[model samples]
Target: MCLNKITLYLLLFCSCINESYSANISEDGSFQLNGYGMVAGDFQSEYNRPKNMTLHADPTGPNQDPRGKMGDLGNSFWHDYYTSLAVTKKWTGIGAPEQWADYTYQVVGYGDKALETAQNYGRFGGLNFLPDESNIWAGRRYLDERINVFAYNTKEVHIDSGIGYSSKNFDFAVGTAQIDWSSSGAPMAAEGSRRIFDLTYRLGLTEWGITYVKELDNPLGTGVQQATSFSAKYTMPNYLGLIKGQSSLQIQYGKGVIAQYLNTSRISVLSEKGDSSVRFTVDGSISQFEDFTVNPAFIYEYTKRDKSADRTTVIPDLAYSGGDMIYGYENETGIFGGVTVKQNLHHQNISMLYEFIVNNTRNKNGVAGANGNAYKISVGPALQLDVLPYIAPLASLTLTYAGGDREVTLLPKASEWRVGYRMEVWF
Candidate 1:
């Protein structure tokens, strides 16, 4: 049979199996199944483009220019679909025996045009050792978070075994996972393996609470990676004479080794092999204002590689939301700042955003700084419909204007304009 016929048959078989199994659960045990499916389509347009900017243009370019006509629009389109199903069963033992399990499956399809576009299919399952205790014992979990077909990739799975305890004041969990990383993304050595250990702790205080998580990853063929993150918050009590509301301050820091097995030519190297980086973040918010609120955050990151290079970044953001209007702006290191404002109406919601970035560097080998300086501005509006309580449709129309100056001999300046729309539904 044809490929399309095979896909149709497989979908039908899955639906029938779900229906048959859902009806077979014992009445004494509670069973529930839930699922959702979504489809999305997108289109883009641009202008004043350089030859190198075209998707299908020749790779060799010293003076490539953008195609600028109706047929030369150089636009490509694709659609995607995603679906997830979850099942849970709970049972109470009359005497002393008890057990429970939860299972979920997710599937993603990238394009309606080609089979090679199929992205991923995932399955997860969790089992509990005891089902009838105030602090029940939970044990086993298996997850396949990343899966890809059309390649030699098999399947990436993680098996986790852990213990968890919960209390009114605090909760804690410790788990160890074995990861089969070979089949994770674009395919690598089949013997690749990773071992992970994680711990989470929570403490409650009179005025606030604190939470922390520490995780470690050791790969059999690679290096060891570690990450630690924490957050704390404080709230004001009404009993205090002048303090009436709540305010929170949170901070987090993390540093670790980054790993990748993909070919460098085919991947964007965010960090070099055996590289280490430190990240610091701070966030604060206050609810003292009656109808309006303000939030501000800052982040700093520094990275160093064993042999290649090093870099640093800083970002700051501020926002205010209340009434019918919401506004925010963000400034990123070496990049542009962005500002946005939104207005809400009884029947519709509208918003606009603008961004401007400048890139300048003395280094001649760097990818971004190779260009003298680049700036871009984008503005758009969005609409949301609340026709039903559980169902709402969203649509966004955006206009993007971008330009940059390259010191290269061929193409010195480039610019473009693009438009796009999107819609979504949820329950």
Candidate 2:
């Protein structure tokens, strides 16, 4: 790993000159290095939907995200693989008695069938310091660390360049990004900027957060195109109040720009007026037994958007109304419920895993025969290195059934089979 010692040292000096700084990231000064990513290959017998789902007629589903479908949601080989490598250095007991400073840089990337097609394109780096009782940070960072579910990371957070301050239990941050997005993810000029601000407070076992988004310049001529997001979450460290596990419940809502909860980076783009979304999630993991464990999650989401129809003007005969017509708002409602059951089949090192998901997303305005619902089940045996910290290799065979409305698959029901190999880890 390449180290930017100069940058880290310069920022470490920041709090020492101030004298009032007091915080310790760790017991002593240390150099910390960590990274996480996934490598996976998936194959399907026939062509099918994209890696994520596009709920019909809905502005968005799963927290107002057209990309509601994720994890193993028909993700092809090309779409299922990515990696992130990060490095961090913390300086403690170096200056001002007890001062903390952190420098981190992470690079995310994607690959193709050939090695040469791979590109490490995303860059997230930042400088963080605790000056006095407040924590100050800047640079492109993962804003909201709280996630609805660990499997798919469904939540709202800005992954852009910004600065933030946190003191006591109150936190505030503002970030800006380009309206247009590219794979490279390089920031653009602020001519037409997508700006975001977030404020959050943690009280006891619950967290309350709100986010506001605005477009500084809109090429579509939509004035004050904006969106807002709010969420209330409660977290419990133990399962059933006694077992060894963790669980959380979250309720979320978004309007205008429509919250892209599934999006890990980049601000959500402009949306048609009157777009709104709502979501509820419960996620938990139980490791009550040494040889058996389970992770379960349930999600319900709804989104609404208004469609427009231009009035017929050139031909007077078809004109029902002299002014433009509003086609009324369309709504989408869906539930994503699933569970992953893990059982150790070997000498407690080899595990058999079963993951099942039921999806039912609908469009109120779609044709009578149209709906987006699927049932998927994936089972695999995993081999984890006992000496290592994570599950290294897990290959699975997946069966997916798409059946809801006849219009969805042009038939009463459709089924597809897939084989996949994946190794995911974060340490």
lDDT: which candidate is best?
Answer: 2
Off by over 4 Å in 2: 1-30, 45-48, 52-66, 73-76, 112-134, 145-151, 182-192, 219-221, 240-244, 259-270, 308-329, 346-348, 364-369, 388-413
Find the candidate with the highest TM-score and give its number. 2
lDDT of 2 at 233: 83
Backbone N/Cα/C clashes per model: 7, 0
* RMSD list, candidates in order: 13.9, 10.3
Instruction: Quote each prediction's TM-score.
Output: 0.46, 0.71
RMSD of 2: 10.3
lDDT of 1 at 92: 43
